[model samples]
Target: MDFGLTIDQKSFINEIAEFCSAHCKAIDINDLEKRGADPEAIEQKLAAKSWYGLPFPEEYGGSGRGYLSVGLLIERLAMGGYPYPGRLQITMLNGLNVLKNGSHAQKMDLLPKICRGERTMSISVTEPNAGSNIASLQTAATPKDDGWVINGQKLYSSGAVGERNIIMVAARTDFSVKAHKGLTLFLVPSTRPGLKFTRLEAMGRNIGGLYEVFFDDVWVPNENVLGEVNKGWSAMTKGFNVERAIVSAGYLGFSERIFNHTVTIANERYGRNGDSGKRGAVMSRLAEFATELQAAKLLTYQALRLADREKLSIEAVCQCKVYGSELAKRLGDFCAEVAGGIGYRMDSLAQWYYRETRIVTVGGGSSQIMRNVAAAQLGLK
Candidate 1:
């Protein structure tokens, strides 16, 4: 695969980097973790530049670039280790999925606002009962006169808080059908009655505001159904592929952050004993992390290219998520180890990195779930 960036892609990369360098200063992980804290100030700050919609269609107030450019933007944002840009990308991509499959009215109402960064969207898939087993999602959408009465609970949904609109969700639309069938995606306004959000406390990337959304007979219009009824299962899966690709890009950025911190600390920090000889062990670990980070980066880029081509099968995307997230965790651990006592201290960047890294293994989908996907794809069972 040709990894070389074209002139346009190169220019896009430069623009994103300049934005991050100029505006992303002084924002650290701790500042991002507070409940009900607003990332909107920084978000609006970036929206002024209009890079928020790089991957959506230009007709919908976007840049109209393809997935390759989108992936590049995500990668750069992740590498900055700042959260607002990543949140923007996640919201834009989720909104785009609705455009890809939702009714014309749905697209018209939502996509433009999302592209302009005036609104945000999120995917609500996980629940107390449904973590990796998406088929087991118990959120129910009962048929009603106007549209559907959605009543269920979702957990760990990122960007639910403070988003203008949300992708309200449900499952088992037809009880006769199997678990995976009849599940559907919906376009619900956060301001809608019966839809409530509770913020979830998490380790890293707190700016994303992971949430528990409850749809208590949340009334949605028939016009809001995304794609066909039973066919939502297929559409949601496709959206997940997109989500995983974006996540892999973020992991790549996070890996770079930890790896850089590890090296910087190793080179400059004295050993707890104040001996320069401690530098030798630190450098050795840094070299090892660098090597692993390179391996994970190459795999992630490969996945990005495949996703750009629309060739990312479930198995391939899962593989990318597994390696990239795990690599991030390993890098974080290495940073903490290299920093010794300082790394373990609260509010230190390395401690934050360590906390954030653990979540990567569990979020998106657990590493075990990815392996299960790969095995099923390979017919190993």
Candidate 2:
């Protein structure tokens, strides 16, 4: 099998890199100090380029690019030290999954807007009580004449604060069945009367607002139910496979960016204490990071390949998510050490990179949970 990208893929990479270079040439130390980008401006900028929907189908007004192209786009954008690309990744890609699984009416209503950047969508899965144990979710959906009344809260919902829609909300439509079996999915409007979004403060990805959302009697119409009642758990699990795959791709890009910066700085930072020995140490550490980054890239690319092949890649997804996220964390730590005192400065992107990488280990699924999945795949307990 060939590992190198084809000419078309190379052209796609070039296009993404050109866009990143044009927009991200001027890095604002002030923005780093502020810890947030102007969301409105960022949205408009990305929308103009159709970056938000690059991975969606053409019918949805997207660029109609595949995941490989999408991954390259995200990597370049994230290397800019702004989380704008991540916000797009969360909103647009997850929204596409909804299009794939949702009713035809649902797709027609939302997909065009999502692709046009007139709207954004986020996934609502993790709740205050159900972080790792997705099947243990307790959000309930009681039947009404025209719809279902939803009541529960979701936590750590990325980009939900100002998003237009979100999918993957699990509600128990049949309590008699097992927890996973009883759950259903819906596309709930974030601006509905019974929905409330609470912003969460965080160390990184500050520009992409994380939120905790409450759904109190949030009425979701029968037309908005994703797939079928009591069958949504499987759909949601499948979506998770997609989510983990792309999220790992984004962080892998970030890891490469941070590692590159650390190497460039280590080679040039002239100091009294920075002897040849220190320089050699930094180079050796960077070599390790490079090796790990290559491992992460291989895993992530393999997962993408599995996804494109329509294979059961749930196990590969877990492995990529776990390994890529951990490698990102390690790269951040090593970068800090290599950069010495300046790395700890709040004004530096290195500090922010470290913070961002820390979130990866916990999000999607914890490293421990990932390991359990990997072990179970191996026929272990």
Query: TM per model?
Result: 0.92, 0.91
- CA RMSD, predictions in order: 2.5, 2.6
Stretches off by above 4 angstroms in model 1 are: 270-276
lDDT of each: 0.76, 0.76
Candidate 2 lDDT by residue in tens digits, 24-137? 657563463354433456567788888777877888787777666676677667765446335678776668667678887878877788778887777788887887887888
Q: Write the per-residue lDDT of candidate 1 for residues 160-227, one digit (tens) a residue.
A: 76636576465558767888886887777777789788887766656667788988988888887888
Return the clash pairs for model 1, or none. none
Worst 10 residues of 2 by lDDT: 29-38
Model 2 TM-score is 0.91
Q: Clash number for model 1? A: 0
TM-score of 1: 0.92
Worst 10 residues of 1 by lDDT: 163-172
